[model samples]
Target chain A: MTAPRSTTTNEPTDPYVDLPVPDQRKQQSWRAQGPIVAMVALGGAVGASARYGASMVWPVAAGSFPWTTLWVNAVGCAVIGVFMVLITEVWAAHRLVRPFFGTGVLGGFTTFSTYALDIQKLVAGGHSRAGLAYLAATLCAALAAVWLAATVTRRLVAWRQR
Target chain B: MNWLLVICGAVVGAPMRYLTDRAVQKRHDTVFPWGTFTVNVVGCLILGLLSGAVATGAASSHVQLLLGTGLCGALTTYSTFSYETLRLAEDGARFFAAANVVASVVAGLGAAFVGVSCAEALWA
Candidate 1:
């Protein structure tokens, strides 16, 4: 998502590198998708397992705030910010690397579904305050984490390159 | 056993997300990230339904572990969503960044609630 399209005012966010060229989608044949999809799957398994393991190790008690998931999501968001910057700007790595690590592993590791569901459960369980707090906190934390991480990573990369 | 179920579900769920993202993204040329948006909402909906079903005994814990914990968890992602939003802001598309966050949260929460109600009507 860090594609340098900001030079032109009309340029849209060329977010994901995997997106096929507009009107040239036919070029992205099914064959090109095989390895990317496989890598995503493989990375996904590792990510989901790690998440499950974390929850197992630090199980959120019934009716308690889901701090574990909040941390997981925040950490994932931070890591992604750094990773996206490095992968898109600094690293000239393999193509499959982004799809595997970024889209697959981190995506699987941090879940929006559980976050939403947890808030729902908290509210339904007579913990509306906790739900509201969590709802706001996770959003704030995720955004802040990504913003700070990306900023710092960019600075570090620039310094090293200089 | 539970770990295996989660892994199996993730093996399928992650790829499903990638392919779905590709399919959705290729359809449009906008940078709004509708691909991630769609999957998050859909995943929340399914997880909500499963939660309701479990609450009402319509689904077992095993199924919940497979579908809810593994499938929905892998299908929807906070990292990508946040990263894209960050990119939009960095690229000076501030409006899109704000809208992306607001819309995703509202839609995701709404879908979760709707799914729960639907499940309550159907199974509960």
Candidate 2:
């Protein structure tokens, strides 16, 4: 039971191996990707809006741990884990779904830039302990959340199939 | 007004990130996630600049909301970075996993600090 589960081997070990090349087959421009762009854009807007709303509800004060951001990132990581597991192992979701939810919404919802700024401010403001604690907690919790969600989701999917 | 701007900024930032990550990853064939790292660093720089402007009264609150809270917020992602790092460690590449975490945090902070400094120099 502790052995590593090799569920999906479809993804390249080096994910960057399949770079998009110029389409010699057609004279189509970058407009061909317009639909995906729109999907991502819409999803991003919604996600960011939700995050802003969350911040408004539980605003982060100066020199304090940003609970909102931490929670958002952790939740986003877990959701992404479950999402990827379902998409890869259980259901073949539409291509647009991945871009909209995985890339756009979840990506927008969980921010690295603000986290960095928060850390800088905390350290500069003499809240180094809180900053360090926040950093460690965010990293550990997020990784754990994703690992747990993905593992459980995968197992559930397998159980259902059996 | 702030809400609208936030949405607009995210509309542009999110897609820009998606495209940039795709383009960058396509060019490099490595297990290390240089694409996400690049975006996060760039976002921190922009956020730092925005913070500086806000602090110096050079920009309005609305501008900060739009650019910093909205654009930068959507552009950089902690989830993907964390997930990727975990995956690396799980795959037995413990060295790369540690490198990812350290490099991202250190470089992101450095970039934000630089951004603020640049903004102060220009504004003040």
Candidate 3:
């Protein structure tokens, strides 16, 4: 005679497909994140300093638009794209370095705040068309530059890998 | 009287931006740059709100500098966003590149408009 059994039944789980498992390798790799942050911060400091220097060197000329800011943003965007490609594909840079140079430095170097301020100043000064033109150029050209940098990097990397 | 406040505001705003970017990156390990997008949109909105407030005299110059220059300046990042979008296109993620551009500009402007309108209404 069989004894009365409990109603609960446990099903066998597949370790690979059904069970949630922590990736130790991924976690270990992320140990590099701290260094990345430092790199980014360093990059930020450099970028900010460069921006200040640019402003001082090229004080706004008597113009309808703020040329200094436009130049800085455009240059910064292009540099960042180039930097990303160089570090990621060419150099295969350490992950920690990315934050400092890419996120922190270049990120800090570029300034949307200044961009907005410039636009406001232009609008306030009744140079609305100039302000709008500046905005368009910044948005479009910056994006294009980034795409170009990335494309160049990818092709180079592919050639190397092959 | 107010310049001190602006300085302090900038100090707080810039670091906050750095931290936020880090946090977003941690959560999403993809190279698509969700963090930059979020920061830019939020920063634009805040700037718009501050602009409206200052124009309406609802906020002080110090407050404006703190929130607008320091905070927003630190928060929104065009360089990184541009870089990442370009990276995606280069990596053959054309769809993502297109989406990033459209979404960032549209959302940023929309957020700014809403922020400005909200501030104007409240101050008025």
Candidate 4:
């Protein structure tokens, strides 16, 4: 998978990004959790299904390295990064949505076991350098992705508010 | 094809993660995120054993899907781990952020090693 060359890092400037702030006209409280939870569940279902579909389509070829896993993890990380920012800033998506898409779907979609297995396979195949490189790249990229997404989303939200 | 098993495993694994995370939070009363750390490490170990077993022809694809795809898939969560670590860093808990990184990577790798060894021993 192709990596995003530049990372985003602006925090949301929108005062009311995702919160349904209370005012004389309306009040927001824990009561909103019910609907939020439902939204999360729905997002989780979609995320999980997409993950399964990806795995099925990109099955590991026999005796080959874990291209399928590498692709999935990288893509999942990037998507979560974007989705997190989108929901938080742009769409001002509900609070429950993160749990479904981020925690449930993306969390399930990205597999540490496969990551470990990929490295093991590389070492087993006498490609120790490649294995280590893969590991380093995956960890660094995944973390940066989230941060960048968060920063960008925050900025986008702020701009929208202005 | 075995969708039922995968779903069941995920349900069990997810709730287990939630309860264990809450328990860890309750006991430690710290921001260390011990629960996610524990789950990831343990998941890596179990997955390692499963992978080893499959490699050595001791396990079947169905078993792999059930345990690997369903259970381990649900058990270990990278997103939460990433988000928490970032939150820690953002909140100025730099030490916690560093600890989160070292602990997860090192322990996760170690657990996978143990699992592989355990599975190999079974065959040996």
| DockQ values per model | 0.60, 0.53, 0.24, 0.26
True contacts kept of each: 0.73, 0.70, 0.27, 0.25
lDDT of 2 by residue, A34-125 (tens): 66778878988988998999999999878888999999999988998888778666786676787788778988898999988888888879
- Per-candidate Cα lDDT values, in order, are 0.86, 0.81, 0.63, 0.66
lDDT of 1 by residue, A14-74 (tens): 3344443344465565567778889899988889999999999999997998999999999
lDDT of 3 by residue, B1-124 (tens): 3434433444444445566765664554344556677778888878888888988999987777556655576566778677666656655667767788778777776777677778889897
How far is A34's C-alpha from truth in model 1 (Å)? 0.4
Residue pairs in steric clash, candidate 4? A9-A151, A10-A151, A11-A154, A12-A154
Give the distance in Å from residue B98's predicted Cα in candidate 2 to where it truly belongs.
Answer: 2.0
Ten contiguous residues minimizing lDDT sum, candidate 4 chain A = A8-17
Is candidate 2 or 4 superior in DockQ? 2
Off by over 4 Å in 4: A1-48, A62-65, A82-98, B2-5
How high is the lDDT of residue A51 in model 2? 90
Please give the ranking of all candidate structures by DockQ, highest first, separated by commas. 1, 2, 4, 3
Best by DockQ: 1
Scored by lDDT, model 4 comes in at 0.66
- Mark the regions of model 1 whose C-alpha exceeds 4 Å error after superposition: A1-28
Which 10 consecutive positions of candidate 3 chain B have the poorest summed lDDT? B1-10
Clashes of 1: 0
Docking class of 3: acceptable
Residue by residue across B1-124, what tens digits does model 4's lDDT show?
6665566556555545544554454444355667788878888998989988987889998898778777787667766677667767876667878888787887888788788888988974
